[model samples]
Target chain A: MEITELRTPCLILDEKKFRDHCNWMKDKCKRLGVNLRPHLKTGKSREVALCQMISQEGPATVSTLLEAENFFSWGVRDLIYAVGISPSKFSRAAELIKKGCRLKVILDNVETAKALSNFCEKSHIEIPVLIEIDCDGHRSGVKPVSPDLIGIASALTDGAKLVGVLTHAGDSYGCVGSKACRKAAENERDSIVLAANRLKEAGFNIEIISVGSTPTATFAENWAGCTEVRCGVYCIGDLVMAGVGVYKLEDLALSLLVEVIGHQKEKGWVITDGGWMALSRDRGTASQAVDYGYGAVCDVNGKILDNLYVKLANQEHGVIVNRTGEAISPEDFPVGTKLRILPNHACAMAAQHHSYHVVNDGKVIAEWPRFCGW
Target chain B: MEITELRTPCLILDEKKFRDHCNWMKDKCKRLGVNLRPHLKTGKSREVALCQMISQEGPATVSTLLEAENFFSWGVRDLIYAVGISPSKFSRAAELIKKGCRLKVILDNVETAKALSNFCEKSHIEIPVLIEIDCDGHRSGVKPVSPDLIGIASALTDGAKLVGVLTHAGDSYGCVGSKACRKAAENERDSIVLAANRLKEAGFNIEIISVGSTPTATFAENWAGCTEVRCGVYCIGDLVMAGVGVYKLEDLALSLLVEVIGHQKEKGWVITDGGWMALSRDRGTASQAVDYGYGAVCDVNGKILDNLYVKLANQEHGVIVNRTGEAISPEDFPVGTKLRILPNHACAMAAQHHSYHVVNDGKVIAEWPRFCGW
Candidate 1:
């Protein structure tokens, strides 16, 4: 089936671009001499993960336990639930582990560590955990040099095992060029390595050191202490990634396919059935070098329309306008005209859809199902 | 089940508040003497719609054909798919109509009207349509005074029936208080009523004149010349609605219940597992009078935690900080503590979760399933 035959305002995944991105990340990991535990948070599809993972029965990174369960059911065994685990998640993690998932969890606090350890001990289940390190003061993680480093690890006494340290250069998204991204990468490496070294010196036998973010993973010149890198969004580049110089617009595998319903001619706006509901309200590029309002406009075959972008989006309406404030011809995008939108954030956009119409050579080859929620 | 025992970062619906909001809208529509065609785009659940809808059979408004189909399956026969109709949606709309759904579609262009007319004629299905009017120059719609109003109406020649006119005061969301809201409401009423009068003078029946939006519907002093008022979001008040002064914070029935996962002491940040993935990427309140960063922080008991909000949101992480920049006490919100976040837009936040945990008093009484995608 062709994508045009499918419903408008739906997710379209370009297979060629997706496979190329997967190979690019794999080659990058190989060149850095580090294991690739591809983060499945971006594309929560077993089919996508199969092409992204290092092996069939392999190491993968998941943000939610639901992703862990779904990927495990699809036969990718070695997994790490990358988000900091709360006590409420312990039972679900244990359930996955009980079902033969080589699953690992992470945390950055003593309370959670103690609770997880106690839950594991009581449930008679062993769960390996990584102590999250705050590299750039981004989001979750303990300070690399803080006293809590050893406290969190030592608190994992009974059934919870402390394996290593993990850090994400989330702030690398703010970096514009490769120079700044490389520096952020080095900081991510040094911070996690410092925490890992501290754990090693304390006789904890830190086995794995993980660090990544699409920008840093792409531009990093060094990965000395890192044994593995966890990166998502690399396999599905977006306008934000393009702004960060991680990849070009040609590398974006995901796009929202929409049909022109009408036009507000005097205002030079082309209204489409697709809105923020399908495109996502992620204005990640708003603070970047270039802001593609909601998303950059593209043709049905995925060629970027010169200066067209979704300037405003409501629940079910996207007002496409020219970036240079030039009036758009209504005849150019008449009713029933199919158009593609390159989202500001691929992860956020993909989450809005239940399935991806995998398009290959301008035709939909398959429908890959994806899931959301915890 | 107690909410404390449930998972974190999930949608919570206050049963009392939801019913109250539903009843409030019903009473308002009754006092105005107009049919309340509640828009199901906000709460896409059969159970929620059963309460908000005028009847189980419904005089409802939907944004997508999927919603029309879903509501029809749940016994809502009368629905107007409120978004402008694209030609691609004709077949699905026909199917719904064939299945005993009194489905009406809206459009603002001659191109769509012609295509829809041809498709309906070919399918031998008579689908009623409403000509959309640009009430506040906000989004899609033909200007109420535009000549294209009659031109598009005339283009609908065969099986597409011209019912009347519809308009939404989408810009009313920008209103800060009731005075501005009332003005926006009057403008909405005048625009649709004017378009309806024009259609009537042009030899059209113009039976169903519809106008609404939560803010406008709540403040409209007059519903003159309108047969029905279409409003959503009123049944699920959000920070955006609160900012518009349509309702107080206590009237908001929807929230994201999240668990405190960790903290950054010196930065005065309490991190939770709920981020944009749960709270949504909609900062709709940012442009309003009072900006609730991502969402206002609330305790598990549904009481607002004054001066606290989600300052930053990653995919699965929300950083809660004091609005006054005062350091937060980590002891006050220890790990595993449950907190609720009031979303900026009800429609965006509810789309993130697959189901709602319906709470009464303090315990979860029911799990209402919801759906997404088109």
Candidate 2:
């Protein structure tokens, strides 16, 4: 099927570009002498994950247990449920672990670690757990130098094994230039290494030390101490990655296939069916050097329409406007004119859809299914 | 099952509040002497629609074709695919019509109207279409007073039936007070009614003249000359509705059930599993009077946590902070402690989940399924 034949506001994955992104990340990790455990949180499809996998003895990271179950069903055994697990989800995680799915979980506090330990002991299941280390104090994680790290590690008793430490340089998203990105990468590596060294000093055999973010992974020149790097979103680059200088506009592998539905010519807007529901409400690049309003509007063939951005978005209506205050005539983009929209954050946009119309050379070569919900 | 036993980061529908909201809107519409065709775009669940329906034969408005199909399967025979329709979606809309569904599609331009006429002619199907009228120059639709309105109306020939006009006062969302909301509501009513009158003068028997928006429907004192009013978000209000004065904070029927996973004690931040993936990135209230960061933080039973808001969010992590810069001890919100988060935009937040756990009197009574996709 042709790309234009698919329903408007549906996610479109550029297959060739997606493969290129995966290969680039794999090659970058190989050059840095670190194993690449590509995060499945970004591309939650088995087809995308297979391209990212280094071998058939798969090791991948996921943000949700749903992703773990989905990928595990597709023969990817080694998986990490990267989010801090609550007691409520232990049974579901244990179920996957008991089925020979080497599922690993992460946590930052002692209270949850103790609860996980209790659950594991009761179920007679040993679950490999990683201590989430805070690299830049961006989101969730124990401070790299905090004493609570060891306390939480010690709390993992019975059937819970303290595998190693992992940290995501989420603050790397705030970095402006390549120099800042490199600095973030260094901080990300140093922080995780510091926590690992502390764990080693405490007599814990820390096997894995993972650290990564799309920006950090793309620019980091050093990965000396980290054993493995986990990165997502690079598999399908977005405008956020582009704003961070991690990817060029052309490197973006996903776009929403939409059509011009109407026009507000006086307001210099061309309304499309791709609204926040399609492009997502992620203004990841809003605070960046370039604010691609909702998204950077593109023509049908995926070429960026310079200066055209989705200035305003309703639930099912996206108003595309020229940034330079240029008026766009209604005739120029009449109703039924097909367009593609590059998203601000690929992860959020992709999550809105259940499947991707995988296009290669302007033709929809395959349909890749994506699962959602916790 | 108890509300506490449900999984984290899932949608929780307050059944009592939802039913109350529905009854309030029903009463309001009755007082105004206009039919209420509740828009199903916000609460996409058929269970919610059943509450909003005036009768067993529902005449609801849907934003997507998937919603139309899902609601149609549940015996909602009358539906309006409310967003401006393009030629690409004609076949799907036609399919629903052929299946004994009274599906009404909307469009605003002559180009699309001509295309729809051609499609109808080829398929030998008389599809009902409403001319979308622009009331406040917010998004899609032809200006109610424009000559193009007549041109677009004339284009709908050969198996395409002109079924009057409709307008959404999207700009009404920007109004601050009840007075402003009423004025916007007046404008919405005047514009669509004007368009309907013009179409009738042109010898077209216009029947269904419709106008609405959550804010407009809530505050409009007069509904004269309009046959029906449509609203969606009122069934499950959000921070935006509160910001617009359409709903009080207590009136919001939807809140996300999330667990406190970790925290940044020094920063007075309580981290949770409900990130943008759960709460959505719709910063609808960011420009409002009181900017609720991601959302207004609430207790387990849906009471707002004074001074607490989700200040920052990651994909699977939400960092909540006190607006007054007071440090909240980690013990106050220990790991595994559950909390509810009110959303900035209910439509965006509700779209993130597949189902809503219906709670009544502190107990989860049922699970209502919701469908998403184009």
Candidate 3:
């Protein structure tokens, strides 16, 4: 079926571009001499994961346990639940571990590590955990050089096994060019490796050292001590990645398929049925060098419409207007005309839909299912 | 089960508060002497609809075809697909109508009216349509006084029935105080009534003159020429509604229940598992009198925490900080501590979850399922 026949405000994934992106990340990992633990938090589809993972049964990272559970059910066993572990989630993690899934959890504080140890000891199950190092002070994680690093690792005494350290250069998203991204990558690598070395010196056998972010992974010239690079969003590049200079605009593989519904000629607005519900309320590109209001506009064939952007979005209505304050002709895009919208953040956009219309050369080849929630 | 036992980053709906909100809206509409067609777009749950609607068979408004389909299957006969109808969605709308649904579609232009007429003529089915009018030049809809109103009305000849005129005070969201909302409400009523009068003067029978928005509906003193007022969101008050002065802070019925995962004590950050994925990226109150970053922070008991807000959000991590720049003690909210986050926009936050844990008297009584997608 053609994409035009599908319902409006639905996700459209370019199969060829998606495969190319996967191959690029795989090749990049090979060149860097690091394992690519493709983060399933972005694509969140088994079909995409089939092409992303090096092996169908191993090496993946997920933000939520639901992703870990779903991927593990699909035979991807070597998974890392990348977010900080809370006690409420321990039972679910333990269940997955007991089911023979090699699921690893991450934590930053001693309190959580002690709690996990107690829970694991009581449940009679052993779980591997990675001490999260705060490389950029971006979000969660312990400071790389702080004493709490060893404190957290030492607290994992009974059923919790200390593996190594993980750090993400989340601040790399703020970097605009390759130079800044490269610096962020080096800082991320140094931070994690320093923490791992400290743990090793303290008599803890550290094996794994993970570090990554889309921008940092793309521009990192050195991956000396890092064993694996955990990066998502690069598999389906978005406007945020494009603005950060990690991926070009044409490399974005996701777009929202919508049809022209009405026009406000005097205001140069061409409205569509795709609103925040479809594109998401993420304004990742609002503070970037180029602000694509909600999303950048493109034709159904994926050709960029030079100056058009979705300026204002309602719940179910997107008002497309010229960025340069030029008038948009209603005759050019009449009602029923199909248009594709490139999202600002791929993960946020993909999270809004349950399935993707896998399009290749102007035809939808298959429907790849995706799930959400914790 | 207690809400504390439920998973983190899940929705919690206050049953008593929700019922109270429903009753308040019902009483307000009764006093105004207008029909209250509760827009099902906000509370997209059967259980919640049981309280909002006047009967099982609804006079409800939906933002998407999926909502219309789901509500119709639940024995709702009278429904309106409130967004502008696109050609790709016509078949789905027709199927619902053919299944004995009194579904109405709204549109603004002559081209779509002609397309609907042609489609209906070919399929030999009758469908009613409302002419969408531009009340405040906010988003979609044609100008209320435009000559194209008669042209579009005339084009709805074949199998399409001209029902009446409809206008939503979407701009009313920009109004802050009750006085501003009252003026916006008056303007919304005048705009739709004027359009209905124009269509009637053209010798066309106009039956439904509908006008509403949460703010406008809450403050509308005169429902003079309107037959029905369609309002959602107010049923589950949010920070946006509170900021608009339509609903007080204590009236918000929906919140995201999340558990404390870790912290950055030096930075006064208390990180949780509920991020943009749960709370949503709708910073609807950012431009209001007081900005609640991502959401207003509250305890699990739904008590508002003084000066605390979710200042920053990642995909699966929410970094909360004090608005007054005061230091936060990690000992106060240790690991496994649960907190409830009041959302910025009820519609956007509610769309992030699949179900709402109905909390009454500190216990989770039932699980009410909600859905998303177009």
- lDDT tens digits by residue: candidate 3, B144-226: 88999999999998889999889999999999889999999999988888899999999998999999899999988999999
DockQ of 1: 0.86
Worst 10 residues of 3 chain B by lDDT: B243-252
Q: Which residue runs of candidate 2 sit more than 4 Å off their true CA positions?
A: none
Over B1-374, each residue of candidate 1 has an lDDT whose tens digit, in order, gives: 98888888899999999998899889988997999999999999999999998789999999988898888988999999999988878888898888899999999999899998899888888989999999888999999899999999999988899998999999998998999999998999889888998889999988899999998998888997999998889998999999889889888999999999999998989999998999989999889877898999999989999999999999999999998989998999999999999999999999999999999989999999999999
How much is B297 displaced in model 3, in angstroms? 0.8
| Candidate 2: true interface contacts recovered | 0.86
Residue A126 C-alpha lDDT in model 3: 94
TM-score of chain A of each: 0.98, 0.98, 0.99
Per-residue CA lDDT of model 2 for A209-305, tens digit only, reads: 9998888998999999999989999889999889888889988999998999888877878999999988889998889889999999889999989
Chain B TM-score of predicted candidate 3 relative to the true chain B: 0.99
Q: What is the interface RMSD of candidate 1, in Å?
A: 0.8
**What's the best-to-worst order under lDDT?**
3, 1, 2
Better TM-score candidate (2, 3): 3
Give the TM-score of each candidate.
0.99, 0.98, 0.99
Q: What residue pairs are clashing in model 1?
A: none
